[model samples]
Target: MNIKKTSVLLTIILISINAFCQQEVSLSSKLKSDKIKAVNRSISLFGDKEDAVEMNAEDESGIGIIEDVEFEKGLIEIELLGENNPGKSFIGIAFNIQNDETYEAIYFRPFNFVAKEQIRKEHMVQYIYHPEFTWRKLRKEKTGEFENEIKMPPNPDDWFKAIIHVEETTVKVFVNDLSEPVLIVDRLTKPLSKKIGIWTGFGSSGRFRNLILKE
Candidate 1:
């Protein structure tokens, strides 16, 4: 082969390898038998014959906890899409998950981020330590401490990227902006090291993709 042709072929090969390395492994392939148990109705996975998981429970919340992946102190990034109707969607991630009913979660109220009412805007993002510091209790006791308004809200119906950084006792959430964090918690309610999973609330449906965890 000519020298120029060989050089071009080598560059193309390197680019192809890099792209394959960055391609996210579908969460659907990591689900375990007991990891994801539908509460009220069955959850659905859709993406080229089902490559992504969607929360579709009607009466109660649905979840798909990834098995064997224990996230301690690192970064978690994912793309999420929620319903656009006001007060209709709750989509987020749960970390330090001890079990099905216990975990620390940070989710977005997409419908509330740009609502007409001020109160709704105040509830754009939420943090909860399940079975204890639920959003209601935290709001009542600590008021404006657990939840914060998203400074730059993204469209509810469109897909948005969420980047979560978890350190020993602190957890910071950044949405679409790497330089500035949208929410920061000095102390996390749950332990620092635990399993991680996707979360949805009652009457909410969401889709997730490109879930990557760095430990």
Candidate 2:
């Protein structure tokens, strides 16, 4: 091709790449939000690891993925890269409770009996909001309060599948091959405080290759 034609081709390629990079992220996509949806400010999570981060394994290994979105009902399918390590011992996603800048809700695993079976506290969605591109935890709470807030949703130590069912008044979580979830949270009747994030407990980690949210 002539020099002018080659230059034109390169320019077209550059524009195509730029347009592709600027595409908006969907609630179910692997890409995290570039900025906060509400405040419209940039939020930086730990070392490029936002609450909703996308990770990939070269050929199926110990890696897992996290995501952030707002879905009422959907099938979030997680694929395991490490097939040899069957029975997985444990692996799955996590969702932290937040109120604007603080997380008042505790992090107890919904099925873990270690935590007291008590009423899930209420959250205000009006002023409160979940992190879209970032996550923040409360720091002023007492020792005991901190323990309660950080409780992993059911089986924090062990891996389990979770289905988030948001109702008119509560959010129910179904875990590990069980038809019923051990924990049923009375969701805040107000609007959604913030976007939901995906979590994979420490030690027991894996990547989410696909997340299909369908009502």
Candidate 3:
């Protein structure tokens, strides 16, 4: 092949490889892909769901502790903590928000860099206290489908920061500030929609300190 042609082919090959090996994101920064949407841009403060809370519980328990949280503009924050309360494993919190509809999924982004091995399982299911979202006996997922897991930080109890970026089909998570999200569950390629408050998973009863959904 001519030198110019050869150079062009090499460039194409490099780009293709980079695109595959390259990650969707490296941190809690902007999303370059068309699928990613920056929904949690703003945060609005509102009333509280004034309710004493505890740890996760058995399924069929109707919102053991419901907090009346409120918000306004954009980003919504759901704060949950065991807070010095040891032996608090299996506790879960349901984030009910008011906004445009969006997909249902969860993930954790440890340092925002998701190792290849992490994408095999569903992180949202395991990390999220709510297993009913797709539990067969619980009968939650209507489609009877499954997707890849969105990895969480190394340790769930560890004091690491994470962000759940919700768009259409894809949910991107960032760990420790914006480091290529520990994992990107689904790369949404569909239209936009609104997502109400996050549902409290079944068999989980945890305390939610702060919950808000911006309008």
- Root-mean-square deviation of each candidate, in angstroms? 5.9, 15.8, 13.2
TM-score of each: 0.81, 0.35, 0.38
The best candidate by lDDT is: 1
Candidate 2 residue lDDT tens string, 1-215 = 99999999999998887665332333223444432232111222222332233332222212211234543333333322211232222233332333333221212222233334343211100111123321123222221222222223333333334444545555554544667554454432333433443332222234333333433
Clashing pairs in 1: none
Q: How close is candidate 3 to the true structure, as a TM-score?
A: 0.38
Each prediction's whole-model lDDT (CA): 0.77, 0.33, 0.34
Candidates sorted by lDDT, best first: 1, 3, 2
Judge candidate 1 at residue 163 and give its lDDT. Answer: 90
The residue-by-residue lDDT of candidate 1 on 138-176, one tens digit each, is 989988887788777998888889998878788898998
Better of 2 and 3 by lDDT: 3
Tens digit of per-residue lDDT, candidate 3, span 8-104: 9999998887565422221111111222221322212122433222333444322321122222123333443322222222222222222322233
Top TM-score hit: 1
lDDT of predicted model 2: 0.33
Model 3, position 36, has a per-residue lDDT of: 21
Report the error of model 2 at residue 46, Å: 15
Scored against the true structure, residue 36 in model 1 reaches a CA lDDT of 57
